[model samples]
Target: MKFTEEHEWLRPEDDVIVVGITQHAATQLGDIVFVELPEVGTEVTKDDEVVVIESVKAASDILAPLDGEIVEINEALPDNPALVNEDPQGEAWFFKIRPSEPQQMDEYMDEAGYLALIS
Candidate 1:
């Protein structure tokens, strides 16, 4: 998993990269109530806002960590937003992207770097 300074995480799977907020971001957001995800095929540049996660605290935007076309969205989130606070790095993933520049992964933070940032 690669992490962005904004707290989004990217996990490459086969030919796509899964996108989600990190546990730290979810924790800070409080209980998530809604998630607005873009349709499949939506193109986004690196750092572009792709989804909005609403919580008791405030609405937060989840940005694309790399340039890509969105391929899939987690359809279950609108009904079960707490999945984000419950399992942020897994079932709570917001979407998957088919990257235009896979090499951009190298620019994201590794686990140790992400942990250090939040600490």
Candidate 2:
């Protein structure tokens, strides 16, 4: 898994990358009440806003970490947004993307680096 400075995490699955916010981000957002995910087939560029999340504290957008095609989304989030607060790095993942430039992932931080950043 790799982490971005924006607090997003990317895990490389079989042929796709699973994307979601880190636990630190969920904690900062407070209680999540709403989620707006992008369409599965949508094409996205690095830094594009792909997921919108509303929390008690504020609304935030999850940016695309790499150029890719959104292939799948967590359909459960719209109905149970609190799952983001519950299991941010696991089941609450926002989407899976098929990266057009997989090597872009190398630019992100490792777990140790991310922890240091937040610390």
Candidate 3:
């Protein structure tokens, strides 16, 4: 997945779309306390705020990557937000989506492209 400074990450995998926070995001967010996930089957639009990840310092919204219905969420994160801190690319994933607009990925950067922006 590639990331933006906004803390959104997007990865296309077959029929499903994987979404989450970047490692830089998790580090900046600090110690997380709660994770508010959207209900499965809810229709979401591109760039809409879908998840709320709260840290001891502040609360931040996680924006949806593309327009789609939320197929699933990471149930474990609500109880353990540190999973995001522990493994931003693994167990801490925020949600799984089936992007309604296939063109969305084309609008975003590749891993190298994103790294260039961050670097």
RMSD per candidate (Å) reads: 0.8, 0.5, 1.1
* Predicted candidate 3 versus true structure: per-residue lDDT over 3-74, tens digit per residue: 655767877778888888888788889988889999999899987899999988999998888899899899
Q: Order of all candidates by TM-score, from best down to worst? A: 2, 1, 3
lDDT by residue (1-119, candidate 2, tens digit) is 99999999999999999999999999999999999999999999999999999999789999999999999999999999999999999999999999999999999999999999999
lDDT of 2 at 114: 100
- Name the better of 1 and 3 by lDDT: 1
Clash pairs, model 3 backbone? none
How many backbone clashes does every candidate have? 0, 0, 0
Which is the leading candidate under lDDT?
Answer: 2
Q: Residue 89 of candidate 2: its Cα lDDT?
A: 94
- Model with the higher TM-score, candidate 1 or 2: 2
Measured with C-alpha atoms, the lDDT of residue 84 in candidate 3 is 87
Q: What TM-score does candidate 1 reach? A: 0.96
Q: What is the TM-score of each candidate against the true structure?
A: 0.96, 0.99, 0.94
- Supply candidate 2's per-residue lDDT for 112: 100
lDDT tens per residue, model 1, 1-119: 89989998889899999989989999999999989999999999987878999999899888788898999999999889999999999999999999999999999999999999999
**Once superposed on the true structure, which residue ranges of model 3 sit more than 4 Å away at CA?**
none
Q: How does candidate 2 score on lDDT?
A: 0.97
